[model samples]
Every structure is written in C-alpha cells, then in structure tokens.
Target: MFNLIKNEWIKIFSRPGTYVMIGLLVLLVIGAGSVMKFAGVSQEPEGDWKQQTQMQIESDKQYLEEMGGSENFQTQYYKQQVAINEYRLANDIEPASGESIWSFVNFNSNFVEIIGLFAIIVAAGIVASEFTWGTIKLLLIRPISRTKILLSKYITVLLFGITLLLTLFLLSTLVGAIFFGGGDGQPHLVYIDGAVEEQNMVFYLIKTYLLKSISITMMATMAFMISAVFRSSSLAIGISLFLLFMGGTATQFISMKYDWAKYSLFANTDLTIYTGAMQPLVDDMTLGFSVTMLIIYFVIFHLLAFIVFKKRDVAA
Candidate 1:
C-alpha cells in the first residue's frame, strides 16, 4: 500500500500543472501579506483593547437600536457581534487589534477555498485522466487489486490536498512574521455560551485550519467520485467547482425559510459555525449533529466512488 501510494504521489507531482498550482499558492500568500502590510490592514489599536471593545459594543448597540425589532439575519449577526464585544470588554480579553502570524492565518483561512479548488482539480483528473489517457489498463496490469489501486489514488489525492493546505499555513506564517513580527504568545479570544474565553493562538489556528479543510475534503471527494464514475475530468471539475462556489450560497438562501436546510451537505460542512464565529442557521444545530451529517455524506460519496471504480471494466 505504501509503495502504491508513493507511486501515485510521484505521478501527481510529475504533472506540470501540479507545480503551477503550488506556485500560485506561494504567490497568493506573498501577495496577501504584502497587501496587508501596505494597506494598513494590520494597524495596532490606539487605545487599550478594552476601550476598543467598548466602542465596538456601543456602535453595535446603536445599530441594533436603529434596526428596531428587525430580527433579520443581518440584525442577528450584529447582535452576536455586540454580545462578543461586550463579553471581551467585561472579561478584560483583548480583541484582535493588529496583524500578526495568528491574525494573518485566521484571516487567510478564506484561501482554503483556493486550496479546495486545487484539490478538486487534482481529484477530478486523477482517475478520469487514467481513462482519458488510456492509462487505466497500464495501472491495473500491475500486481495490485483494483481496490488497492483506487485506494492508492484516493490517498494520494488527499495527501496532495493536505500538502497544499500546510504550504498555505506555513508560507503565510513565514510571510506574516517577516512583516508583522511574532505574536509573543497571544491568546485568541473566543465567545461561547455567553462567556469570553482565551485559547492559545497556535492551537486556535490549527483548529481553524482543520475545520476549514473539511469543506475542501468533501468537495474533493465529490469530484473524485464523479471522475471515477463518468470518466470525464472536465465534467467532474466543472460540476465540483460550481458546487464549491455556489452550493454554500444556495444553501444559505434556502435555509432562511426551510428547516431541511440544516441537513444539507453544505450546511454541515462548515464546522466553524459551532466555534461561535457565527450562529447556526437552525437553533437546534450542534457540533455533534453537523459532524454526523458530514460523516453520512462522506460515507455515501466514498461508497459510490469505490463501488463504481471497483466494478468498472478497464477492457471497455
């Protein structure tokens, strides 16, 4: 299995496109860091964090009053922010004030979407390209079972995705440190259950990275399944990108009026909602429930992909 996975890994990196993807990631990291430095995105607060927190709370409260009994999504979001800012001030916790490695990674978590897109591209091509290039027979002629071959390819795709994610994190951290200096062991302020708490910056960043990667993983799996079943890399990539970019927005809109939206795959994939960064669309949604939903969808995707690949005839 190790040897097979290694071979598959080699095959992935052998493609020029893989190197291009890595290059793009590096450029993006540097570009974002430069932009932050030049645009004053990392300016330090003039007053104490408590003062800043108070000002934020007051501003949000005034906005809430202006909102005047409108319980729309935007109002709820502002209310949540007010609660969090108030908690920060009361607990003497520092609100995020300036740019640092921690802040950079936290903000750049959005780049995980880029990583996801790259992973989808790889996954969409991994299997279908074998068929497109007439390499499936060459792969199967080896001394391995069909299951092993499929597993190796899948494993390699996951490793590639993980590699890109780590590269993003590490590169962003290095660039951030170069520009903003070290964090001096700052703590991330988190608001949960009507309380403010402190968590280690590194730990929080790691958790954030993992949670963000979940959406990428699910999207890649879907792409991989489509590639295997349809044997068309273009089709697989196109459909997966559409879902990656649009599915979440569509789910959010549907969730506004429908309870069933809670069970949608997109709804469950973003585990960050449970971290108190935002509220769940449904009041009853919980970490455990979202995790369960993800597991179910993950299993279904893998089962379909594996079953189809295993039963497929290379001779055809």
Candidate 2:
C-alpha cells in the first residue's frame, strides 16, 4: 500500500503541470500580499483607535437593534459583527496598526477557492486520465487488487489536495511576513451565544481552512466517481468546476423555500456554519446533522466509484 501510494504520489509530481500549478498559487498569494500592503495604510492616527473602535461598536449596536427582528442571514451577519466589535472594544484590542503578517494571512483565506480549484482539477483527472492515456490496463495488471489500486489513487489525490492547501498557508504566511512585519499575533474574535469571545487566531484560521476545504473534498469525490464510471477526465472536470462555481448559489436558492434543502450536499459541505460564520439554513440544522449527511454522501460516492472501477472492462 505504501509503495503504491508513493508511486501514485510520484506520478502526480512527475508532471511539470503540477509544479506550474504550485508556482502560480504562490505567485497569487504574493500578488495579493502586495496589493493588500499598498491598498490602504489606515491613515487613522494612533491616538484615535480607541475612539474609532468605540464609534464602530456603537454603530454596530444600532444596526443590531435595527436588525433584531429579521431572521435572515444578514441579521446573523450583523449580530456577529456586533458581537465582535463589542468584544474588541471591551478587550482593548485595537485593530492592527497596519497590515501585519497575521492580517495578510487572514486575508489570504479568501483564496482557498483557488486551492480547491487546483485540487478539483487534479482529482477530476487523476483516475480518468489513466484510461484516457490508455494506462489502466498496465496499472491493473500489476499484482495489486483493483480496490487497492483505486484506493491508492484516491489517497494520492487527497494528499495532493492537502499539499496544495498547506502550500497556500505556508507561502502566504511567509510572504505576508516578508511584506508585513510579524510583530502582531493574529487574534480572532468570534460571536457565540450572543456574546463575543476571543479565540486563538491560529486555531481559528486553521479551523476556517479545514471547514472551507470540505467543498473540495466533496467535489473531488464526485469527480472521481464520474471519472471511474465515465472514463472521461474532461467531462468530470467540467461538471466539477461548474458545480464548484454555482453549487452554493443554487443551494441557497433551494433553501429559501424547501425544508429538505438542509439535506443537500452543498448545504452540509460548508461546515463553517457550525463555527458561527452564519446561521444554519434550517434552524434545526446542527453540526451532527451535517456531518451525518456528509458521511452518507461520502459513502455513496465511494461506493459508486469502486463498484464501477471493479467491474469496468478495459479494452486492450
């Protein structure tokens, strides 16, 4: 199994395209850091930070009161803002004096979608390309069982996905530090149970990263299943990318009128709601419920992939 995984891993990195993808991602992070550095120096003089924070807090309070009766997502957003601002005011945690490394790293979280796109491309192609390139027969004729072969490929793709994520994190942090000093420890303020709480910034960032990556996992799994069943990398990649862009929006629209939308794969894929990023689409939705739904979908995806692969006939 280890050797198979290693071989698969080697195959992935053996391609110059993989290196190009990684390089492009790094360049993207650096470009974002440069833009952030020059965008706004926050010319607010040092002495007025407290006053500024206090004013922001009061404004948020007003907004919160105004939004008190609205049960939509925007209300939850305002509530979260109110909680965080109040916490910052209470804790005397002024905003960063400038764009620090921590701020840059935090800002880079928005780019996780790019990482997911790379992962989806890899996952979408990894299995189907074997057939596309006419290497399936050679791969299966090895003494390895078909199940182990598929598992190795899946593991390899997942490892590749994780590698891309970590690359983004590490490169963003290093580049951010180079551009913005590292003196400030990025701290996060979270709203919980009608109150704002201070949490380890690193922990929050890592949690955010993992939660956001779940969509990649689901899309990759879908692509892998499509590849195994259809033996077409382009088809798998097209559908996966289309869903990646439109799935969340479609899910939101579905959730507006349908209670069953809570069971949707996209709805559960975004685990950030559990971390209070927003209110659940269904008031009854909980972390456990979403996890269970995801697990069911995950099992179904793998079952389709493996069953199709195990029975698939390769023309010599």
Global lDDT of each model?
0.87, 0.84
TM-score for each model: 0.94, 0.93
Backbone clash count, each prediction separately: 0, 0
Best by lDDT: 1
Cα displacement (angstroms), candidate 2, residue 222, comes to 1.2
Query: Candidate 1 regions off by >4 Å?
Result: 47-52, 68-70
Residue 79, candidate 2: C-alpha displacement in angstroms: 1.7
**lDDT of each residue in 166-199, candidate 2, tens digit only:** 9888988899878887746647677766666677
Where in model 2 is the C-alpha error above 4 Å?
A: 39-47, 64-68
**lDDT of model number 2:** 0.84
Candidate 1 per-residue C-alpha lDDT over 204-239 given as tens digits, one digit per residue, 9 for 90 to 100? 888989999999999999999999999999999999
Model 2 is weakest, by summed lDDT over 10 consecutive residues, at: 40-49
Pairs of residues at least 3 apart in sequence or in different chains that clash in candidate 1: none
